[model samples]
Target: MRILAVLLMLTMLPVASAKEPYKAKPGVAGNITSVGSDTLGNLMTFWADRFKGHYPHVTFQIQASGSSTAPSALTEGTANVGPMSRELKESELNYFASTHGYEPTVLVVAIDAIALFADLHNPIEGLSLPQIDAIFSITRYCGGEQPLRFWHQLGLEGQWANKRIQLFGRNSVSGTYGLFKQKALCNGDFLPTVNEQPGSASVVQSVAYSDGALGYAGFGYKIAGVKTLPVSPGDGPYVKPSMVNIASGDYPLSRFLYLVVNKPPGQALPLLEQEFIRFILSEEGQKLVERDGFIPIPERLIRRQLNKIAGDV
Candidate 1:
């Protein structure tokens, strides 16, 4: 009877000791605040809503005013997380370092390709980087190219030829605006005639409604009335801002989106903030990226991010 009981106990041990997959502990509930990047606002909202399902007691305060506002918010301690469509500038990092004595943690959350849009009826199919510079820059500083103010300069004819190119873009406060200036305009000043809208959706809408309008915006803002234009670097074949092209590095304007977190020296991320980052980098969370029209971070990158979060780097 003792030998039989030992055998049964040994059998039960295997079942009782089996390890389950790790899930984050629901630590103390608190409000998690995020700010910056109007371009990432919708994506952040989706994440916040879904995250609430797992952490029902936690609340979120998200502010997507613009990417330029993110660093300031972090410095002031108003935001715990900053979702930016572009990487933080060196000055912004320095500001955080000044206040907190450590640089903020940056997690690349998604991939984006900045798309150039034209009115749906426009027959022009593509533009080179220099040509984009000529269209949007006052000095045409990218290649010393001639300013292309009228559609006729681009080889249009008849009524289309006489029309002035209507320009639309995000305001200076926006990351999209900064990126377009850097990538397309070669960091030159925007042409004074260009209309600077407050957001990406507005840029899309402005171009969509105008007869000869052209604008730049993120791929997620692609709408029915505007057509995406393939773009070429000076030496390469033109590539559209599709997921495959962006992922393959064929798209010239592709960039990484980031989630910025403040962590002072010798400290770990707050419980709620760490859990939120874990969720955003998880497989289930990446599916939301695809659903929201952004490219999910690749598995290798995800692993790197997880290691960073774990302070293993």
Candidate 2:
């Protein structure tokens, strides 16, 4: 009887460990406000929901307008947290410095790739960065010396030959838009003919339905009817935006997603805010990142962010 009981206990150990939930240390209850990037909106909401399960008294006010608006919300004291898909502009940082006398804390939470998409029926297989620049920019830069207005310029044949390229992209307010302009367009202005959408989803939807449409958005927003185009840096061997490619730095458009906060000099973050950020950098939180279709920050980056947070505290 004793031997049988020992065997049974051993058999249940693995199951018990697998079913154990992540434990988060509780903190003071308060309302937490977040505003920023539409790209990080869904992921932030998921984090809030899970965090609330640990601290039931905590409430969240989240607004995902655009990354460009995050700086204003933080400076105005309307939001305590800012989620952004791109790095803060120098002007934004300077504004915070001028107001608070210090720089805000920036933490990288995940990785994303800006994917170029076209209607599934489009025969074009891929594009170089220069080609993309020419397609979207009014004043082409990099290696794209002339504007590519028609499909024939991109080597498409048959009915696509002379068809005018229908461009769709995020508006000026989007961080994704800014990043695309910087990396793909080489800081050139967008063409006047481009249709500016309000959100990533809108860009994907427009491209998926319009036969001649081409647009760019985060990899997570890819839809079924649209095909993602492989991209190269003005050369051959174009790479698709895949998990492995983005993680390995093979994807040209890959970028880090961030969480921003203003911490007073020589002071720690607010109790609730610190706890929330701790939870976000935890292994369980990174699991949520992977679940949401974004790449998790690697272990090394995670350790660096945690150490930075500790230093701030």
Clashes of each: 1, 0
Cα lDDT over the full model 2: 0.84
> Candidate 2's residue-wise lDDT over 48-163, tens digit each?
99999899999999998899999988988999999998888989999989998888888888888899999898999899999999999987876787889999998999999988
lDDT of 2 at 62: 92
The TM-score of candidate 2 is 0.90
Which residue pairs in candidate 2 collide?
A: none
lDDT of 2 at 70: 93
Candidate 1: tens digits of C-alpha lDDT, residues 168-269: 888888888888888888889999888988888989998988879999988889999889999989757788889988866578887778888887545667
Q: What residue runs in model 2 are displaced by over 4 Å at the alpha carbon?
A: 1-22
- Relative to the true structure, candidate 1 has a C-alpha RMSD (angstroms) of 11.6
lDDT measured at residue 79 in model 2 versus the true structure, 0 to 100: 96
